[model samples]
Target: MLPNEFSSSPARVSGMDVGLRSHMQRIYNRMTVGVLITALVSFYIGHNEELLRVIFGTPLKWVVMLAPLAIVMFGFNPARMSSGALRLSFIALSVLYGVSFGAIFAVYTGESIAKAFFVATSMFAGISIFGYTTKKDLSAMGSFAVMGMIGVLVLSLINIFVASSLMSNVIAGVGILAFGGMTAWETQRMKEMYSSRDNEEMASRMSWAAALNLYISFIAMFQYVLHFMGQRN
Candidate 1:
């Protein structure tokens, strides 16, 4: 009786598998779209020095830099935000990141930037695949990666004042490692988040939130990878 009650019927199991795949696909699609928006905006801003100066030259740049962090604060409270609000917040955050990251063009050669981008994409794909396919539980690794990320953020702030190029490079290197683990862990967690009982609105809000998580991980890894691989202009 217990075995019969606990087992899912074959059709039910098949339906569940299909639903899981569909949900996972939605998360990936959303994440991809967000990444493209960021890349395009970054490229556009990076090419126009005048616009870059106008935005980054003054105190207003603080808002550009801080806005992404602010969106992340909102993202942490996804339970309170509606799906539309969460989606708009993600878009705003991505554009803000692009604007802030325009400095990459000022410092790195185009060829090096392209090379770094290609390599980062390949690496990201591999890590994400591992996370999706692996049976190993990554929950602890996720916690550790988050701690590493906090350390990197704090060190990055300190290095800004210290003006140490070596330290900056070190930070970038560590950032790649930290965000690499984060990408895999985030993928696993996103997969684990699927619930058959969720309503459409709930699923969508969660999807937006998960997409933001993956988008952040991907962008951070790309930036750090580019920093280390890119040639100075």
Candidate 2:
């Protein structure tokens, strides 16, 4: 007998797979659009030192530093919010990330950034596809990725005070691995969490959660990869 959550009716699994596929597609599409927006904005602002200084200088420094974290808070919230609200949160997060990445364009050569972005894109697509199709459970990787992320964050915070170049590189390297794992793990997670019976509110909230996680992972990985090839001003 099927579990209560899956329904015990004559349709068996019913349209659950169909609905899940559509939901997953939306999540990926939303995340991809957000990444594109962030990249465009970041690339645009990267070339303009005047605008960069305006946004990143003075009191704005605090805002620029904290904005990504703030957007993440809204994006990850699973409080049964509306789809529009969820989507807006994702967009807000993406914009803040783009603004933060603007600094990279100033520091890195355009060619290097382009090369690294392409590499990251290829890697992201491969792993994300694996996550979507693999029948194996990724909950273990998800747990470990979370721990890896926390470690990376702690190391990064320490580097700010230590200002050690060695530690910075180590953190960047680990960041690539951590976020890469997260992208795959989160994709698998979304597949696992999906439910056809979930109302629009539930689906929206969960879908955004998945999309937001993937977005942040991609951005983090892209930045770290760029560091290796960046032309350091």
Candidate 3:
């Protein structure tokens, strides 16, 4: 019996690993779709001068800018929401983000935007891979990063009125580091969260939640990277 149990252990462990990989893949696939949607929407709105002006140049810009945040804060309850509702919420958030980010085209040159995006993608991929593969626990680092992010958010809000270039640069520098840490932390957390026992709905909800976390981290990293690399028009 002892030999039989030992012989089966490897297969069980291998199955678990396969399940984890599949779960992570689903999370990544959802995130990729969200990123593509945001990119396409932003590109469309950015290229249209009249639409850009109508959205960003008018009082409606505030709504476009803050709607995603509002939805995230108030309506992103995956536990209570069905998978369909979660998907709709994710799409709406992505579209709102795209609308807000469309202003970047008016501010930064295309070459700089592309360069920053490439850098951000490379950094995110490397960091996430490390997190997924490393045996070390990053919960402490994640907590610290969350605190740093909150600080960054507060500073950013303050800088909106202060409008100091030095402070803005400082925020961007700190934000890049914070978001980079968050990418790794979130990846590790997602791996740990995966379980074969979860029902289909539960698994789907978890995937959406993980995707949202990674998506936010990636977008934040990209924006911070753009701040440093982007050439203003």
Candidate 3, position 194, lDDT = 79
lDDT of 3 at 50: 96
Mark the regions of model 1 whose C-alpha exceeds 4 Å error after superposition. Answer: 1-8
RMSD of 1: 2.2
Residues 1-233 of candidate 3: C-alpha lDDT, one tens digit per residue:
99999999999999988988898999999998988899889988888899999998899999998899998888788889988898999999999999888988888999999999999999999999999999999998899889889989999999999999999999998898898889999999988877643688898898998899999999999999999999999
- TM for every model, in the order presented, reads 0.92, 0.89, 0.97
Count the clashes in each prediction: 0, 0, 0
Scored by CA lDDT, what does every candidate get? 0.86, 0.83, 0.91
Q: List where candidate 3 sits over 4 angstroms from the true fold.
A: none
Measured by lDDT, the strongest candidate is 3
Worst 10 residues of 3 by lDDT: 191-200
- Shift of residue 125 alpha carbon in model 3, Å: 0.4
lDDT of 1 by residue, 1-233 (tens): 87776585777888978988898899889988888888889889999989888988988899999889987985545788888888888888888898898888888998998898899889989999999899999998898889889989999999989989899888898888888999899888877888633798888888888888888988888888887788989
Can you list the residue pairs that collide in candidate 3? none
Worst 10 residues of 2 by lDDT: 5-14
lDDT of 2 at 48: 86
Best by TM-score: 3
| Model 2 superposed RMSD (Cα) | 3.5
